[model samples]
Target: MSTETSVTPSLDRAMCAELDAADPLASFRDRFALPEGVIYLDGNSLGALPKDTAAHVQRVITEEWGDGLIRSWNDAGWFAKPVALGDRLAPLIGAAPGEVVLGDSTSASLFQTAVAAVRLRPGRRVVVSERGNFPTDLYMLEAVQELLGGGEPLERRLIHDDGPTLDDVLDDDVAVVVLTHVDYRTGRMRDLAEVTRQVQAVGALMLWDLCHSVGAVPVDLNAAGADFAIGCTYKYLNGGPGAPSFIWVAERHHAAARPALTGWHGHARPFDFELGYAPAEGITRFRVGTPQLLSVAALEASLDIWSEVDLDAIREKSLRLTELFISLVDARLAPWGIGVASPRQSARRGSQVALRVDDGFAVMQALIERGVIGDFRAPDLMRFGFAPLYVSHTDVWDAVANLEDILSTEVWREARFARRGAVT
Candidate 1:
């Protein structure tokens, strides 16, 4: 509970073994395809591959596509994957059946839902958000506003004070309040329940960008009274890169809420070729296009593994791993000018911890060279993500040891490491 800085002993293999023995999800680590001699701490960016994804994708490609051809869409159950996968993912995020649907990128889903929210609240012009939200969320909102420009152009109210409270901005004129449940840079979390209540107090809709918080933190969207939500599959879900994203609309919105992107797939009678667009009942109306079978299959494979594990357990282990990393790094690396940028309070933090150092990029490059794989953000933040399913406690200890060695020897000063890479 102490926010006051203090140091703990360096992480050791013995401590790791004890933690691993106590971990309920320890056996689940074998389900991933982690590289040998490397400690992966970038699950917040792209998750490590699930072992089943290869075979699942192969079956979809060879049998479903090669054999079944266009007929596979119906025979192989490809048409239902979006809603089916949503049902599978519902329990992890505390959403009920028929409330969530999968499709499109996170940005596209946000645009669709934001437009729907505006339509639901007539005559509202303002959309509340925070400045530090992920760039795509902000950009998508701007694009939507531009596309629908009348006197009702969407306006953004960015929060930018020390621990700024959003209560004041929840006015009657605000149509939607879009926010990232967990901050991408600082790993800070917002109280979803309280924020939803505040936004609804003035008859405004709450749209949560759950890209960072979905699998890493415990979220009860239904319990929190969340109106709409969207998130990607790649991060803590262990789905592969560029995986399709999901959108959830409360059941209350199903009958009345109108989808902005009214594609043929979402029409109630697609085969009838109706001239008018009558939206499909329930969450199926959120589907904007044909499902990506390969990506959805990969997500299914990963979610299969997740289905056997408890989300609450994942959250607990995530906190333990992050806390251990912070304690160890602060004790050993603080003398070299590393400052923890993430919130010290566990409740306010996500699965990742951000550390600030003068040469963060080069330091990360050195760590990568030494078999530890964390990422470097802009300016000076070194981001380390702890994936509870695949990352072991021993990996955390090894990563810290490599960091300590790099800082002690100043190996990051090498000219080769100082040069920026394409991906970083």
Candidate 2:
């Protein structure tokens, strides 16, 4: 495929209709419960809700919890949901069943895996990561360092490499290399296989934060030889907000890897109620605490819809949608000082396309008011995500049309739109 296969889009709705008609995934749009008149481009931030989620949550509350109470943990199979959900999600990222499990928040998962990686290589005293990584990652790493880094002189070296490759950073001193698979702000992608190989070659383990790469992009965790990985389900997975994050540890590290946050649930035999903690065999050990039952139930409902869907189709549609948005923005919005901050090449980018624009927060707020719901990142980036399962080509075309109208009329300059919200 061309680096950026551009689509002029004819500046017309008919073209979008034609594209939609040809889309194999078109019928899936009705499966979501998006608000009327809204073109949701924020799935990269929070996914659109699946139609079955509410009913499932109701059942969990009314039947499982209300009636069965504590017995529901066994009867309703609540205890096994994390592993089951992880199995369902495995193929999406090309991971095997026993390698992944869901629990805890993304930050917590990152902390566990990083600590374990450091412990595995006691002599190594440095953890190398990108300076541009999401703040939570750097914060979590710093937290890990303070707890573990003592007289031995440990360092959390944040590299500012302009390129994705860590040619200058990976070394024997580095116990583990932490990097996000896709950049959160700019939507740029890293070569996972290449990076993993390089890290391992230097005797350092590789841990990837797959938050932005899991659903929209295809990741072969085992194929890339990635030692460890962690990701959230709430984005393109369509899992509800605060849905548990998942962690994947290579089978080789299962016996050696010991997470710091050892809870009763992660214990090998919780029923035994032993005095000391013995981690459960396999991925079950990654369980942090009692599962967030209702949220996981909601996620199960979402995953049920995802069970039959092919990820290749999702990746294919994502590129098409983003390519359309980029082309439209380049052709129409450059004069407004709105330029693509993300990679122009589809292969080099994730599912979201970020635009560097003046007053990005205000512009995104304006777009939201106009019913185009993308989001703003700090320091001038407006990100729009394309989730193929529900978002149609017509939605993309209409969103672009709305943006063009708003830019041309200077609707973004309104004082109400300029006023910032706490969340943005």
* TM-scores of all candidate predictions against the true structure: 0.96, 0.97
Model 2 lowest lDDT segment of ten: 1-10
lDDT of 2 by residue, 1-424 (tens): 3567578735567888888999988888888999999999999889999998999899999999999999999999988888988898888887898888997899999998988888888878888899899999999998778777875447877777565347777778989999999999889999999989988999999999999998889899999988999999999998999998989998888987888789888899998999999998888887888989888998899889888788888888889888888888877777787889889888889999888887878778888987889999888998998888888888888887788788788878888887776887
| Model 1: per-residue Cα lDDT over 75-162, one tens digit each | 9888888998999999878899888889799999999898888888878888888878899998988976776557455777877546
Global lDDT of each model?
A: 0.87, 0.87
Which candidate gets the maximum TM-score versus the true structure? 2
lDDT of 2 at 361: 82
Write out the backbone clash pairs for model 2.
none
